[model samples]
Target: MTEPARDTIHCARFLPHPPAAVWRALTDPELHARWWAAGDVKPLVGHRFTLDMGSFGSQPCEVTAVEDERLLAYRFAERTLDTTLTWRLEPEGTGTRLFLTHSGFDLDSPMGRQAYEGMGRGWPHVLERLDAALGEAA
Candidate 1:
């Protein structure tokens, strides 16, 4: 018997900002566009939106869970990628410890494998951009 694929990307970053600032960057469409894709993201569950992923085109997403400045989760890329992206925030000293989980990649398929590999390499840079964006605003 073969073991199930453990295909998930986990990233954590310590932002020198409060949880509220990090939360805003994750949910506010304008702020989000600066660090990542432009989307009508909100901290309310069931909100549906699309992120303009440049060459990757527009990717649909639906908010699945939220907890103020604590946590946010959404279905990402819908039919194509079919993954969930989750963010969690924790207060650490005078900063916020942010965690990200990108899950549900069907590694057996070519598209899934490619996305898994590509995104795995890409998320760190994205987080760095997030940090820089926050820094600029401060």
Candidate 2:
């Protein structure tokens, strides 16, 4: 018998900012904290960091892959949730198209299911906050 496929959260947002600007928002700790969680995220592979996820406490993360301002993939939540978050930035017209893939949800577990559902609903708002943060920077 085979197990079921895991759930993955996919989100895309077109920000009216250059890829470099969006990339800074994703990589720079202060800019990232303004939009998302506070973390020492860097565009360097194999770097380890912790994101302060507010009420959910801090989550450990590790940079698994990075490609300059183009792509970044990281292991999120480490041993507990054990998920991967990949961010892809593509230049689009006058702005940037940002794609987010949050995968490795073990839906069989209650914690995983809840997190999958919660984050699925929460990502849009998070992206909106990112846009607002970019606007402030602009």
Which residue segments of model 2 deviate by more than 4 Å? 1-6
For each candidate, what is the lDDT?
Answer: 0.95, 0.95
**Which runs of model 1 end up more than 4 angstroms from their true locations?**
1-5
128: Cα error in model 1, Å: 0.2
Deviation (Å) of 102 in candidate 2: 0.2
**Tens digit per residue, CA lDDT, model 1, 50-75:** 99999999999999999999999999
What local lDDT score does residue 60 receive in model 1, on the 0 to 100 scale? 98
Candidate 1: residue 88 lDDT (0-100): 98
Worst 10 residues of 1 by lDDT: 2-11
- The number of clashing residue pairs in model 1 is 0
